[model samples]
Target: MGMEYQLFYWPSIQGRGEFVRLALEEAGVAYLDVARTKGGMENMLAALKADAHPSLAPPFLKAGDETIGQTANILLFLGARHGLAPRRAQGRLWAHQLQLTIADLVSEVHDTHHPVGIALYYEDQKKEAKRRAEEFIASRVPKFFGYFERMLTRPEHRGVYLLGARLSYVDLSMFQMIEGLRYAFPNAMARLEPGYPGLHKLHAHVAARANIARYLASPRRIPFNEEGIFRHYPELDEPAA
Candidate 1:
């Protein structure tokens, strides 16, 4: 069958849409990136301003008649429908909880570059960004990684994946998180990653998956740049400790 779902997001930057893209890609689901299509971006923007069930931002999913918004909510729906989530309620809830944590991490990462305000240019907030990025590298990164490391060690947890043996949406998200952090804070990650063996292993494992490997090699994988959430500013990166 042809691709049925329409993913509405900024065509240039990976942004929050990448989480949804990874889930769809790993599931091998055929879907069109609406904004990437001709005249589709206009439609997406119009939908954002529409009167009915308007999406507040990009990364919204149009699945048949349902319009779903929010990165976590979109993943939750896709996970259950596409077998990327646990079949059991408790397991599913755990996956959602993990995803929420990932979202929290993402927001903090964004704030590091735009500490003063997203409306302000990075050049305009260079001083504040430097301070925020330092704090993120020294404290936030470890605290988040510490939680993820502990989560992997839980008795019920599967060493290979966040929830269990099966790859879930949370796993894909975790992969994205690691990728973003490494891109945005290479030195910090290089210094900090050795302490997070499990997270490092999982990140490697996800990248090695057949589908993901193919996806990364394809045009669908947008190059990480300053326009995206995970920006690389040499001054923001810490020296290896």
Candidate 2:
């Protein structure tokens, strides 16, 4: 690539930024993980304050003169440029819509562990979290998976991906979703996986991709921990119905 791709995100967790990282890694694009660089966190904070276009949070991407924020927005831009998205306008919109839906699920997942507020500790909200988790595990999980299940059953989407016959950013996002859900709710996923065979198949297929498999084995991929959106709190999760 002519322009240097600079990714500004927190250095520790695989948060939202990991979605952007996955596209870049899959496409074999060379980019600098700016925050991981020397004084990278300082640089990211400084850029946020200094740049003419302000971003509300991290996981922003800078490419030459243009800067983009939001994981879906970043993925949309990268998908079009890197052949990670469909060619038609309708296909593109469908993919973007799917990504936005995934974003919604991510937010819900985060809230399961922090029902009160991000400023408060999880311990402060465990009771609420448990209630929220019950609804989420019993309702939201099947609802979201059902939507994708229907999409995959479409005539055009005969393959493992959510879009067309090929893998798009949406598929990658689904892979990330599965990874997070499994890490956070192993028993729930194990029980639910049987019902959503297509989703599990998609997840396994994406995991087997050459680039993704390599990325998984690499040091670059951060392991899931307590800090990320998907956290494994024994009380916050339950076995699937």
Candidate 3:
């Protein structure tokens, strides 16, 4: 805890980095958003290459001398250190399992905007993106949201958070998911959100947390933009049937 955690990621756009940021903020952990600092981009680039176990991409964490990569892996590590995850093996694994599922959903969301390839501009893949987004909005949205809704409404875990009564990183990620999807697909969400009352309630619960509220109000919380996973492309979003 003495060593200040250093987060290495892109200077702009919340992207996947925001998930980690939200966990840290909610846990009241002090971390240096390295890329936002002077010469920080260079530092991030260097860390990506120089580390013993180089990460495939950004959004990795450096705690003390250990470098943790991947969003879920990093979260798994931080979740244990902080009280952001469950104490027991079964509960912790359950939290991580939900996190992995969320990761899959996030990947799908990214592909909707960049269906053809990440290297290609959205303009180059507009037709494909439209098709993908249409299917996602029609099918995937309900599939994922319904699963989470049911999870929250389970018999045993009858709480506002995902892992039941406690506030886990899963809840934080769900809040981000709703926030991102709402930005990316406002029309669709406006029509669809009413069905998922538990998610709405959970979103409100996380948003009102003292630390998270402060973070949201501060400049540290980057605004959603075209560059992030959640983009407000008018054609890609529509109200549900």
| Alpha-carbon lDDT of model 3 | 0.93
Residue-wise lDDT of candidate 2 within 1-241, one digit each (tens)?
3536999999989999999989998888889898988999999999899877768998999988898998999999999999999989998998899999999999999999998899999999999999999889999999999999888887665788887579999999999999999999988888887898888889999999999999999989989999988899988778545
Worst lDDT run of 10 residues, candidate 1, spans: 50-59
Where does model 2 exceed 4 Å of error? 1-3, 239-241
Tens digit of per-residue lDDT, candidate 1, span 57-169: 88899888888999999999999999999999998999999999999999999999999987999999999999999999889989999999988878777658887688899
Local distance difference test, each candidate:
0.91, 0.90, 0.93
Could you tell me which residue pairs clash in candidate 2? none
- What is the Cα-based lDDT of residue 125 in candidate 3? 98
RMSD of each: 1.3, 1.7, 1.5
Total clashes in model 3, counting residue pairs 3 or more apart in sequence or in different chains: 0
**Backbone clash tally (model 2):** 0
Q: Among all windows of ten consecutive residues in candidate 2, which has the lowest summed lDDT? A: 155-164
Better of 1 and 3 by lDDT: 3
